[model samples]
Target: MYEMDGEEIFVIDGHVHLWDARQENIIHEGGEQFLQCFYDYHTGFTPEEEQWDIDTYRHYGADRMTEDLFGNATADMAIFQPTYLDDFYDEGFNTTEQNAELAEEYPERFVLNGSFDPRDGEEGLRYLEHLKEEYDIPGVKLYTAEWRDDSKGWRLDSDDAFEFLEKCADLGIENINAHKGPTIRPLNRDAFDVKDIDDAASSFPELNFIVNHVGLPRLDDFCWIAAQEPNVYGGLAVASAMTTNRPRKFGEIMGELLYWLGEDRVLFGSDYALWNPDWLVDQVMNAELTDEQRDEYGVELDVETMKKVMGENAAELYDIDIEAKKRQFRDDDITERFDLGTHYGGDAGAAAD
Candidate 1:
């Protein structure tokens, strides 16, 4: 939890990953290129002192990941959104099983989400069902642009993709997180298209569709679509990275989002491993819209609004009861490990409070 203006904010990092992009894991050259691209993004936006070495970044083990988040007390909880690049890597990058290794150890501190490729067809459907049965995952992260054997990518609005969405609705997995970011090498431009979300969000009103990075580089298109679709949400991952050096851009983006999607629909994402929540959370929590933006958008970036984007909105989507989780975390394994009892009102009616 973070103390800001005398209020405790229970931060839920909506996007994070635990993956292996080591040389050994690299089967195809695309894996190497992909990992390099991530490093470029890290160094491109991150502060010099806060950055990590390439070796450390490639495989920063579970121990460090746990400490980087909750140990600093910047983020109260985190959600694992897996990215499986099977075609690129020998062992898929950040699969649910890899993240579950850490999540299972600290269930109170993490929300484990699974992944599915519509290209996998029936086998994919069974795997998704297995994820829900095995882990009871509340959501699934998707990589629509992921390269398959011969295909470059698939569409979310397609009949095959709808089958998985329908299965999720049937199995009670409500959150559909799609990777809608800038175009990258090996992955085609069609992969990051935000238009497909319009149909999918409309088709599955029961499920919530979160567009990661707010479909940046296509912000206007995303905002216009989100303006019409109530179920579509924005996850601030790549967008939040701008807080370091691109405040004006951040303010403008936030302004548009608030103007279009409103406060309740935006969620925070550290895009961890790309950026650590330890420092990134502090940057994001302190984000403010300029007066011009406030006037233009006709909205306020007040504490209550930040509270929702920082944690509460994600809590609503995941059905996480904040009060109950607070009591649980007061004496949970993380608290015991970090000695953060006092933070959660320990001994002063910790549970009651």
Candidate 2:
């Protein structure tokens, strides 16, 4: 929990992953390169002391994740977003089945979000139903660029994809978090384009479309689409990390997001394992938009807005009662057992190590 000026903030990391990227999972050289690519993003933005070695980075299991997110990072709850890179890894990377285990062990602390591949067609739709039944998932994370057999990627606007979206609507899975940001190697860059979101958002008015990373490198396009579509939301995963490395750019991005999408439609996420929530949360809590920036973007980053972005927005989306969850956190033995004192400063980075 982050407290400021006598107000306590309930934190929910809207995006997180638990994956198997170990050497054994690597199918070929591209798999190793994919790991290296992620490592580059991790090391480039991460503080020197917080950076993880390759061995630890490849497979940081559930215990470390629990410590990082809930114990040391000030998050009251986290939503697991699965990224199943079946083509790159032998056993597939971070499937819903793996994430569901964590949700099961600590039911109160986590929300399990399943995934779907539109390319799978009718069979895929059946799998989605099975996932919802087996895991009791409330939402799903869609990786439009994930490789499957001969197909390299997919789009939200595709016919089969629309069918899946319709199924989600019918099944009561309303939140659709789409990965429209950075492209892992072997996937075409166009696959990360934000254009498809426009069509999908229009087609699926009942369902919410949260574009992950806010479609970085294409923020303008995302903002344009989000501005026109009431149901389209911006997920602040990669953009939030920019607060550490590129504060000005981060301000600009936040300014634009608030200006276009408003406070209610934006959600916070650390893109965990790639980035830790401790610093991200602390940085966002402490960050302020300059007067010139406010004038330029015609937006403000006030306390209330910050409060909404950190957790309240997500709580509302997931239908989680913040006050109730806070009470549960206070009574949780696991939360009580771990010391959160180190989270005060840069020392939080060492907790992950």
Per-residue lDDT of 164 in model 2: 94
- Model 2 clash pairs are none
Per-residue CA lDDT of model 2 for 57-131, tens digit only, reads: 899998888888877647878999998887778887788988876788888889898989988888999999998
Candidate 2, residue 247: lDDT:
85
Query: What would you estimate as the lDDT of candidate 1?
Result: 0.90
Model 1 clash number: 0
| TM-score of each predicted structure versus truth | 0.97, 0.93
Q: What's the distance in Å from true for residue 34, model 1? A: 0.6
Model 2 vs. true fold: TM? 0.93
The residue-by-residue lDDT of candidate 1 on 99-150, one tens digit each, is: 9999999988899999888888899999999999999999999987776777
Worst 10 residues of 1 by lDDT: 182-191
For each candidate in the order shown, give its overall lDDT on alpha carbons: 0.90, 0.84
